[model samples]
Target: MDRLTAFVSGAVQGVGFRWWTRSQALELGLAGSATNRADGRVEVVAEGPRPALEDLLARLGEQPSARARPGRVDAVVDLWTPARGVQGFRSR
Candidate 1:
């Protein structure tokens, strides 16, 4: 399993980014959460197979919605390891 925490900036907040993330994560069978930060960014934490996580990251890099364009994605770590206790994908 792999865990990833990414901070995404740009027109993220209020543009359905969280929902889009949740949907994609679920489709990839990833467990995690996507939340809107007060500083105008979206924080996404996902745990799953490395390949699935990578695919999710790629999806997140795309436009979340017609009105939302992602500017940057800052992954906290380049490598991933198993993270215990994550259940299901969610928007928070």
Candidate 2:
């Protein structure tokens, strides 16, 4: 198990970014949340396998498939750590 906390920036709020993130996380069998921050960034936190978390991070950065990503993603800064075991994925 692993934990990934990704800070997504650039045109990410009020555009279903969190919703898109929740879908991706749930598809990868991850448990976490995507939240809109006050500093014009979206914070994505997921707990699961490292591979899955990495995939999620890539997707957040809009790699492999730009059409799948919501809004315009300029960058995604992420951090990996031990999993804290979340319940389910959500958009908040």
Candidate 3:
């Protein structure tokens, strides 16, 4: 398993971004949390197979579509770490 922590910037607050992240993470069978930080960025931490985590990263930067991303996303910066047995995805 891999642990990825991504910091997302732009119009992310109060736009259901965390909820959307939770849904995507759950769909990919990942365990972690999407947290809103005081600096107005959403911090997404996910632990799962590397492939699934990669997919989630891709989803986080998805283009506008039928089900577009929750808000206007300007950038996403992430770091990878060893997984520590996260249990379930949650929107914090």
Candidate 4:
């Protein structure tokens, strides 16, 4: 598996972005959480397979947030071993 981090920007806050992300991640069988940064950006850390991760990015790019804008991300995806099994996706 792999872990991916995405820093989503623009219209990403206060529009149910985190809730949407949590749902999407869970649907994609990803493990992690999404949260709003103090600077009004959204942060996501998801762990899943490569293809699925790519798919998630594609989907996110296709569907921009309604409240905040999504900007370029400083993302890193690498081999990830889950220490504790994830129960569900959440917004933090």
TM-score of each: 0.79, 0.93, 0.94, 0.73
Candidate 4 residues 10-39, lDDT tens each? 677787768877878878888888888998
Q: Which residue pairs come into collision in candidate 3? A: none
lDDT of 1 by residue, 4-41 (tens): 88877776778677887888888889998998889888
Which whole-number lDDT from 0 to 100 does residue 83 have in model 3?
99
* Candidate 3 residue-wise lDDT, 1-92, digit = tens: 89999999989999999999998899899999999999999999999999999999888876662456789788899999999998988888
lDDT of each: 0.75, 0.88, 0.91, 0.68
lDDT of 1 at 72: 42
Assess candidate 2 and give its TM-score to the true structure.
0.93
TM-score of 3: 0.94
Task: Tell how far residue 19 is off in model 3, in angstroms.
Answer: 0.3
Winning candidate number (lDDT): 3
**What clash count goes with each model?**
0, 0, 0, 8
Q: Which digits, one per residue and each the tens of the lDDT, describe model 2 over residues 30-83?
A: 999999999999999999988888888888886545647778888889888899
For model 3, give the 10-residue run with minimal summed lDDT.
60-69
Residue 35 Cα positional deviation in candidate 2, in Å, after optimal superposition = 0.4
Q: Model 1's lDDT to the true fold?
A: 0.75
